[model samples]
Target: MFQKVLIWFLLSAFFLTAWPVSAYLPSDPLYSEQSYLAYINIPQAWDIAQGAGVTVAILDSGVDINHPDLKFNIWKNSKEISGDGLDNDDNGYIDDTSGWDFVDSDNDPSPVASPEYSQLSISHGTALAGLIGSVANNGLGLAGIAFNSKIMPLRILQSDGEGLVETLVEAINYAVKNGADIINLSLVGFEYNVALENAVRQANQSGVLIVAAAGNAESDQSAKDLNIEPAYPACYGNNSGDNLVVAVSSLAVSGQKSAFSNYGADCIDLSALGEDISSLAYYNPAQGLNNYYSYNWYGTSFSTAIVSGVAALAKSKNLSLDASDLTILLKSGAENIDALNPDFKGKLGTGRIDALKVLNSSLPATGKLIKLNQSSAVYYLDSEKIRHLFPNQNIFFSWYNGTWKDQTVEIVSQEKFDSFKIGQNVIIRPGTKLVKFQNSGRLYAVSFNGLLHNADSLTLTELYGDYDSRVVTIQNSFESDYTRGEKLSGLTYPDGSLIQYDNSDKIWYLEAGQKRELTDDSLVLNGFRSEYIIKNVNSDFYYNIGRPIKNLESNIFTYFLTK
Candidate 1:
């Protein structure tokens, strides 16, 4: 039973998916600066790069191209004319003027009603797109992360928020071939598909970076841990020391690990703003694309978009920066948040992403990056004014999150800046215990996000004269697809809405009101062939649907199948 969380994070039983649309929902007119934008110093980055001249492909439940804030930033394939009935771009897809929609097998990639969410709730693509590259300074809705980057909307997941292994593979190839510099995958599942590995490899070869969510399930799926499952594509690492994908975790505005975020000492790259985020959402009846800055949009999926936008911004500053360069800049430049999470020292990826640090680094910097002595980081001077040395720098740490970045200050004995000398550990932030240094011969364990291997250590003169690993990523998201998914004990009704089971009371009742005993014995959470189903009674029809949908609930059924 693989449980999937929505990128938008609505967190309802029947709606294992995310995102919404209400005409009466309040809109933020002057969405000047989100708390996260200020936290990450995005305003400073805006002066350097807004991801101009870059193509960021959103492989999700299609983008609302008609959104007032997103229309200008949408990538228009000049080679193809809409509805011309011709393969205008000569790219296999016929008349793909804006982008291709793999689910509906059509050229239109507009946001649609997901069957899983009561046949009215829209998927997450539009909101995620707003975060990545919605139009800026247009005097409309909220400003996007990469305000000027061209957005290529590719719909691979079904509207119900599920995707197939084959569909994902084709989407990766499509994004790569269609000139996507970065791809955001906020969705995740426990299943491991070999085709995904191959697709990621191909994307890597094409110099396309895939930023994936570390997943919303709070399982501690670390690299060394054997009890839990690792998020796919995000955990897809090759032995060649080349990572084309970056796994991202979610963070609250308080700069602490979100309660819903998945953490691993070695399974994640870095975290970004995912809690109570504000962006643009799609409303039904075309209410001119309502802004969603007030309603909290939560998920690692949103964080993935943030990272992808940052990558695009980095690419803007230096076009030569590839996936590897993007990776390094993000990991190293992130604000060291290990101080915020003492219990999760090296496990919460590198740290929270900081736009100022990333852009200030002058990414694509040509030099052998320095490595921090994970066990022996110092403040360059001791309390008694002495130079310190720890020979066991290499033995103290292991590879987990992408990089371990510790800020170095010119050593001064008296300060509150969280500086340290040899054999010193302190409380840097609330609930965070950072071990700045340890003794020479102690068998200390360290975890890093980068791939661990043979190290030919080189000393550099950056950050307290400490040599650390060459930290790397720059940014991922996915939709909710729980149909064909197993019956978890505390799970919702299978494709049946308005009705739910109370495990505690052992009764089924209307979710809109109270619980009652089921009068119908056969009214079990009937997988695909629910009382709400009509067309397909056999298992074959359900399995081939790509994602699960309630055919009987409403006339609109969302299923992804390669045409």
Candidate 2:
């Protein structure tokens, strides 16, 4: 009888034969664990997020809702029906009690038992879910950073860890609509699609915070060597909007970027824990384990989820903060990693997301201005100094001699002002001493000059900088004494042709063999060109002289010349 009972207990404990019992248990007290969380400052983060009521939405494979460590924190759609074969909430998903599974086209996303460990990778989704918001201080398993926050699992990817763009889009929409304060996207692909970009935009407009993995390709993802390249969503969404997206990188144990993680000056916005990370794994019924708890994988994907959880924590504290404002706060709260690498200073954003700093710091009403450049029009604040702007704020500026001129000359074509040459300017009212000021519902001083110009003919050098510094000039002009109003016809070059306009008519006419007229009016014939068109002329036209014209037509006419 004793032998029979022991056998029964063993059979019950080991749900599946393939589940590795040794890996699920915590490392021996005598041995130091080789995991990412072992090095992270979780205690500090806990102090801040313990009370914050943040809710993170994980859009991956479905989470194991019954997992002991995750059951208490899993978000449920109380309005939706469960297993009734009915769409009670009318949210388009049927019985999505926990989260929808796009791969199976059903709500039941329980992990399946597999003989091989590799075959059991579908457990990744559940593992990630546990890492983001597992029940904390339960004395059962490792604790997540934000232990008390809610975890909304939206399964979009399949068991193979691959998903379609359409499904991902739907998942994103659903997450935002379901009151997910922060959306975590741990999957990435090597495709650039407009549809996906629009989905991200829609999420942003809904004030949903999105954090994406920068991908695992080691080399610079932004390099031109990768043909037809561009990792989807993450690379495409960074800096796409103020509150839409943030691309994150991964830091290894040595404080260096992960070898498998992709990095680019323009692609990734920040770095976080990526290597040797520990998280929950699916229970392998084949190993006869009743519960699943394994931590053996590491990737930038996990880092992104942690950041998402932190963002959720912030949201719980201040529900009124917008996406942009929240992003600023998160970035500002990061702790600097390795004070020696100045090169990585701004490269890693404000630093790794620090939960305590974020929770304790005063919420600034001001927003941040990222990627500020001269091309950005400064109608309000024109100075080089950074200025804060509040919502619904307006910036006012006094008209200067070299400022406030129309940068675009033509209505249809894109003929822009030549920074090298003096262009048109406008004047302001009397006693309106040229003063540059920025307003975010309030006035603030900036680095712009307030000199009054004699006329609207402001030179690019004065307004911005040297014309040549803006873009390389390419010249494509055919000599002909064409009269004003007489459309210059039949001028074509290779696909990319740089044509300079010197006439006052502000129009370049294109005529094809007396059959078709292709006039390029108001030609600011500098910079790069991919296509060509003829339209009305304007004052902002420029001429380039040293570039190859991709497409050309034999018969061409020049309507006006400045000489």
Question: How do the residues 144-235 of candidate 2 rate in per-residue lDDT, one tens digit apiece?
Answer: 66677788877765555556778788778888777777788887776666777777776665556788876665344332211235455666
Tens-place lDDT per residue, model 1, 72-184, is: 99988888877879997788999988888887888888866643542222547877888888777665666777888999998877667766667667778888887788888
lDDT of each: 0.57, 0.50
The 10-residue segment of model 1 with minimum total lDDT is 473-482
Each prediction's total of clashing residue pairs, residues at least 3 apart in sequence or on different chains, is 33, 54
Superposed on all Cα atoms, model 2 deviates from the true structure by an RMSD in Å of: 18.0
* Top-scoring candidate (TM-score): 1
